[model samples]
Target: MIKNANIGVVLVTFNRLEKLKKTLESYAEQTLYPQYIIVVNNASNDGTTDFLAEWENEASPYKRIVINLSHNLGGSGGYYAGEKEAIKLSASWIMVADDDAYPSADYIEGMDSFIQSYIGGRLAAVCGSVVEKGSYALWHRRFKRKGFSLEYSEVTRPEDYQKKDFEVSYISYVGPVMNKVALQEVGLVDKDFFIWNDDIEHMQRLGKYGKMFCVPRYELHHDVDSQNSALSWKSYYGLRNNLVLLKRYFPLRFLIVLSLLTAKAILCPLKGKCLQEMRLRLTAIKDGLVGNLGIHPVYKPGWSLKKSV
Candidate 1:
């Protein structure tokens, strides 16, 4: 069993300054502090730079480091950069976190113990449950898969995941603590997927090497504030990246799911904000048919934000 594993935390942030600060504070409060805390700023025009400067000035015993990227590399790029840094620091494990999410005080401690107990090194990744803030709406919907009756659909507590470990085709990468050795064997996140589905793709790849566990005992609050409107660019990426993920991983299954989802989006255009979602789905299909890849700005000159909503 791996003992005294040196862990590193990587947090990626964009324009959310307040949430990011809270996440950092959570990191500082960890019982077993990470050897390195790296924050990758994804070119936020907001006061993110200033806030980082102020945070740097405030003395903290933990080792805190920040890397400001000139352009917005999106979530995939930021994680890629952070992973590289963690490797350079010789970290045995890397905990990836979204700027809006923060772990419990005993998060790292629990993860370390869990790792030792189950020989986590043999697994590709270990992830925790993400508790949604405010209404708990997101959390409720996460496992609410219609048409299929999942045994663990109603699980809300850690004890719900009592099963030792199992293989999953898809696993959330929001705040997963990955095994450095497994990562080296399977490779890193797909950089082509700028945002969404990158985690799904990585999970799919990792499953080839070893198992992934959802350690529900260790939880974190994923702060997802309700937004008034959907950004056109975000819709584009969600649709486009999902298409890429489907093509790269589950081509046949994706086609079937896409067709069903598309039909649903068209029929209930207004409900669940399906109108905007339909647009993204269609556009993603078009982009895939035409063969488009790599990074592109969310907002273009002609794209109407109102039309998207």
Candidate 2:
């Protein structure tokens, strides 16, 4: 261990018992174990509780804190809750990852060393490199500016990141180690963003506080087979949150993004997998433009977002 590194690793999970187990197993094998493992369970009806009961009871080298919520708080809310708990632990560093993010055994070691190497550097966080499980392709390792807004660089090659470290405009939630100093400086993660784009919004805000860098030397496996826009509810939240983030961080680019949304809405039906997906996108854009956010009926049967709101 790195002598009281005090790195707290937070995870937000729901209805992903098996995936969560694998992720925890990976952490258990880490060469440099985190001081704390904080997991925010988003009201999972699955056997996650029972699994965790057994898992946490096993011998471990660190503290395991599990927060079971009363209801499903979505990704953003779960992360916020977990991060808050990690912060309360007075950890010097905090690293949050999704349930499916499986890091290499040396990932924690590499990150600990990287932070130690940059004792006097202005680093907001160190985002680890993530590769798609099946394709083995690097997931947008670079964050950058697009037309009036932010965008990710194209799928990168492994050799592209041969450098020890490189600066980035944003950090993904796949796996990013953050120092308490930077966390307090940037502020808490926004809970309003119930799902997608929450990480992007937080990263944008965080970039203003300090610099972000990608450490490809640290490896991660993001078990994402594909990103099909056909998932109505997923696409809905994604676009909705994307618009909300764009407006929050890049108001000048609001119209630019809005214009693009309009185009997508108009042509989506023709190119999209089905009319349902197109409609979801349209509804997302409308709600986004009107600043409307809440639980929607599409996610639950016979229920409406208004009820939750």
Candidate 3:
């Protein structure tokens, strides 16, 4: 571990108290613990606030800090808020994680070692491999090289990363370690995105300043299958934000590839699947056309309890 580096781990959560607890448990067992742990509670009504307070009171190793927002800020907002706090704390490196991802005991140690070795002044951010919890299948894949096209391919196990440091188009924010200096140079995640594609957008900006690396040896366990599942609003933002990203950074050839992919999604063969995809695509396009990128909040039934403990 880099003893000189003050690393802060930031976790963003909504109502997944149980998953957050699991993530914390894994963090508590880390071989190379962060200087501090910050949890951004996004207006959760599911006893999340009380649970955080309780966890803070009974912490084992790392310093526990919680910042409760008055309303839901979505993933992008939560990450931006956490990153801002991390910068305020003067952390050299900030590790961003989802509430459901659990890193192994040596995960941070591996990341620190990798960063110390390959990350000259040119390295801005480092991303780790994310493996599914149950099936152990690939969830997150390696990042595309600077001039390469973006593709979602399966990553193999035993998690050995490519050695050389290279410029990447984007890296997964699920378990990415960001350099504060780079963030200050490029700016934090775009709050306009609200959620989807925010990480990609941030990485794209950071690439202008320095290189982004993927440390596959440092792996995390994500409890969900990110590849297959797609929430309605997530799909909408993804399609819209991808368009925005493509328009901003992608080359003309890649733009054509993206358009083809979008067309395929809109014109899939199966009736049910095609209609659903088309609806999401159309809604996203409509929202983009009218400058309505923000999505309406959807609360679960009976979610407005006065107090949860």
lDDT of each: 0.69, 0.77, 0.72
Question: Is candidate 2 or 3 superior in lDDT?
Answer: 2
Report the C-alpha lDDT of model 3 over 1-309, residue by residue, as the tens digit: 224335789999999999999999898778777888999999999999999988877845567789999987888889989988888886688999899999988878877877778736787878766777544334343445445344422344333345433334466778888888988988998876777778877877887888776666567888874453544456667667766666566656446756675676667545455455565566665454445655444322222212211
Per-candidate RMSD vs. true structure?
A: 5.2, 4.0, 5.7
- Score residue 5 of candidate 2 by CA lDDT: 52
Candidate 2: where are CA atoms >4 Å away? 1-4, 134-137, 150-159, 266-278, 300-309
Q: Can you write out model 2's per-residue Cα lDDT over 1-309, one digit (the tens) per residue?
A: 334355889999999888999999999888888888988888888999877777667777888888998988788889999888887886788999999989999888888888778865587888678878544445545556465663533445567578777777766788988867877888878886678777878877777777777777677888775664335456677788888877776777777888888787778657844555566778888888888875665653223333433
TM-score of 2: 0.87
Question: Model 3 compared with the native: what TM-score?
Answer: 0.79
Return whichever of 1 and 2 wins on TM-score.
2
Superior candidate under TM-score, 1 versus 3: 3
Candidate 3: stretches off by over 4 Å:
1-5, 59-61, 134-139, 145-169, 225-231, 251-279, 289-291, 297-309
Clashes within 3 Å, all models in order: 0, 1, 0
Q: Whose lDDT is higher: candidate 1's or candidate 3's?
A: 3
Q: Which model scores highest in TM-score?
A: 2
Tens-digit per-residue lDDT, 18-64, candidate 1: 89989988887787777778889988878999889778667765567
Measured against the true structure, the TM-scores of the candidates, in listed sequence, are 0.78, 0.87, 0.79
Model 1 residue 37 lDDT? 83
Name the best candidate (by lDDT).
2
